[model samples]
Target: MHAGTSNFLKAFPIKFAILIATFISLLLVGCSDEAPGAKVPAFKAPDSKAAAKSGAPGGKGPGGPGGRGNKTFAVEGYIAEFHKPSGSFQTMATLEALNRVELSAAANGRLVNLYAKDGASVQKGSLLAKIDDSELKAQLKQAESSLHLAQQKMERTKGLVEKNAATTTDMEAAEASLKSAEASVELIKAQIAKTEVRAPFSGKLGFVNVSVGAWVTTGTSIATLSEVTKLKAKFALPQRYATTLKVGNPITLIDEERAIQKVGKVTALDATISESSRTRQIMVTVDNSKGELIAGGYAKVSVELQSGRTQTIPVPAEALTLDKDGAYIFVVQDGKASMRRVETGLRTPIAVDVISGLNEGDTVITSGLISIRQGSSVRIREIRNNTDYEVD
Candidate 1:
């Protein structure tokens, strides 16, 4: 029995060596069986640790035929537009009346008639008030009588000179006296006309400084007149937008404090940038026939930047992702996510115009962007037709 045990021990080592040789041969044959450059289909393998805990193999067969990946990604997409036409920008603005004036007394006199009331509408050249002209009118009457007497003396002198009754020098002196009297009459008439005050233009009247029977002097401010039929808004922006600002461009007036809104057009632009603000001033004209807007009021001006280009590539603003490198986006191509860097141009509230790196018809992932890397295989479970705005 001792001799049989030694022989068995020796044979056991030889059998073990044979088993090792056979395993190496199988491994070599298995490696050579696959042809070079041939692809092996991939499939989700079970977890090795779980398989070992359950005492099962981790290997699994390839996915079902059709060359489609098994991993599915639920996501929403936005199709970029290549022909977006417009964009919007907003800025602070100041409202001013198209025409405003402070009516002042042109001459010193007692106010006899007050024709204009507070907040009253008056037409151009309309009567507003009249000052007492009693003294001036009396002087005008005396001047007219003196001028008539001077004219009679000049006529009598001319006839006497023709008949040799008077000299030519006396006739010339009479004519000069007649001219002096005529000048006095015109001066008094002009002074009397100044007593009647009139509106300079059509507008609404403000508070009056004097009432009837009150004494007023020249240069005394009487009231304010504003042409509220139309209004003008002035706003400023960076000098870079000088070329983009055009005559007749659209402008929207928004007064959030009073909840008022109106539309207007850019009437004029400053010739150069303002040195103090380093900005370009633009003027917008709006119709205020309804008297809704007040002069010297506050509001916001929204300017639409059309950039003169009718076509632009637009993508959802939220779809854009920013990094230190620059702006980038994830696009789905052939059921896979591809990350691409892009350059942006004009941006609106809803979307951004892509200047480069993306083309029309490129599907951009607007939703379900987390955890997806470049070249990630994805199965589209839901295709959203909304390509204009963000999902949320």
Candidate 2:
């Protein structure tokens, strides 16, 4: 081959290789513009109104092509109703006697006399036990002797003064002495009274914590005395119900263990709400004149806010939602889910009392909560009563 021709052939091979590499790069760039099966289309300006209606970046509205407009969440709905009202709320309460006290020894001494029998009824001011007041009686006798002597001396001093045999100052001193002796006698008698244990009120006695001859100090418990003519149920109520609960409102007390139910009346309420628990203390007084109930037992207390029949709208509990803003629920309005802030009262396993923000005969969305949003289109596949809906 000629030298010039050979050089041209070698340069041609290098140029051909460069052309192949450029073609491969062009193919890669084309592939990068779209997925394997996708086709690139011409660009078009998004319609502002349609984009706003869709609430999305694309102009395809809910009903538009390539949009979620036609999509609707299938959910269960419940018709809220004004049902016959029952208890406003139920809470655990502690039962207390109308009057209860632990009788303690007023004076420190050995119990010389004790009438200790459990469940024994006693009368007010009755002597239950008498302590050994022997030393006190001796002191009283000594004081009486001194009192007698002082009385005699005072009479003599008065006579002397009238007869001009004694000074007025002397007579005054004698009278003062007589008063001092009388005080001493009374003091000894009061001390003797302390040695005896007397019933402060008419009630039944508990177990005798001390026996005769058992030495006890002041404030030592002897027995418990409880007046069970009536009972009090004490419980705490949420502060939100403070306005509805009044001093004379009726309440129901239930002893589940004994299956006993009794009606009671609100007697007292806390003046201020508790900051920590946001609740108010309540005391309900119940008639126990027949001795049907025992004190110091627990009871289930239910409060009635109204005098007679009450009506309140109730919704399925699952329909209720809570957030930092407080409780809310979703109601189907115009075939779309609309959220409503609600004030709720009592709640049951299946239903929640809607105090406000909802009305009777309103449709509440009970199911498909996870897939629904505010203003989302919803289709109620099944409509049921508020109490009939079950949470899945």
Candidate 3:
């Protein structure tokens, strides 16, 4: 039995070795078949510039996710082009009364009567108010009585002197007494006239603060009087228009308050230019006989010069960059900004006329001045035209 057991053990080692070899072969074949469909980590190519540029559909271009590194600036654009001036040139103007004054009491007295009410139209020399003149009247009566007695006495003295009954000194003294009484009467009469306040000129009157029996002093508050029969519309124009403006020149005033337009003449022009504004004052006299035009109302003045109209290139005043080198502007050409120096002419409130330095079809950058420099790339966000039509 022992010998049989030993032989079996020896045979078992070989059989076990054979069994292990068969299992290894089967595992190798199975792996080979599966390997055909297996996915090895995809051998990815290194990132290249071409890959980034030809990025996936609908991706940003050039610089990072946001695109090109050039800082993006939002700005407005304007086109410089020729424009015609209006048929008639218009300017800012203010309307004013031809004559305006606050009528005050000239003498100190109690107001006895007020002839006109507030907002009453009065004629020149018309009685406006009356002060208490009773005291003045009595003074005049007493002075006259004294003058009568003195005159009689002077006559008697002169007769006595002529007849040698009175001395020459007595005659001179009587004459002096008579003259003094007469002078007193005249002074009282003058005072009486002042008691009756009258309108100095034809105009419309305003409200009075005091009622009847109100004691008033010299230069006391009374009422306002303005001669609106003809209103004087005063406006200022640039000094360059001084020569063109002259007396008798036709002027049209637009009353903004009343929404009415009126025709008038250039009654006067200021002799000198105002140093502060460098403008000349023009006075237009408009007839307001119907009292339609109000004093102190605003108006727009326009004058049609008998000259031809012209076209000009106008740009916004903000676009101009001024320095020691003169005026310059940034113009966008071919996606790049270029600085161009230009000569400027007349300027209005919103725009300046480009007399030189720019031509038609020029695109001027109006905004984002700080974000851009010469040769900088720009994208147009919006555009505006500041050209204006003007009459020369």
Write down the lDDT of every candidate, Cα atoms only.
0.81, 0.84, 0.81
Which is the leading candidate under TM-score? 2
Q: Provide TM-scores for the models.
A: 0.55, 0.62, 0.57
Q: Which residue runs does candidate 2 get wrong by more than 4 Å?
A: 1-84, 87-94, 156-168, 236-265, 272-280, 286-290, 298-302, 306-392
> After TM-score superposition, what is the CA distance of residue 54 in candidate 3 from its true location, in Å?
49
For model 3, the stretches where C-alpha displacement exceeds 4 angstroms are 1-87, 157-175, 306-392
Best by lDDT: 2
lDDT of 2 by residue, 244-309 (tens): 788888899999998999999999988999999878999999999888889989999887645443
**Model 1: per-residue Cα lDDT at residue 103:** 87
Worst 10 residues of 3 by lDDT: 56-65
Give every collision pair in model 1: none
Give lDDT tens digits, candidate 1, residues 140-246: 99999999999999999999999999998999899999999999999999998888888888999989877888889998777899999999999996654556778
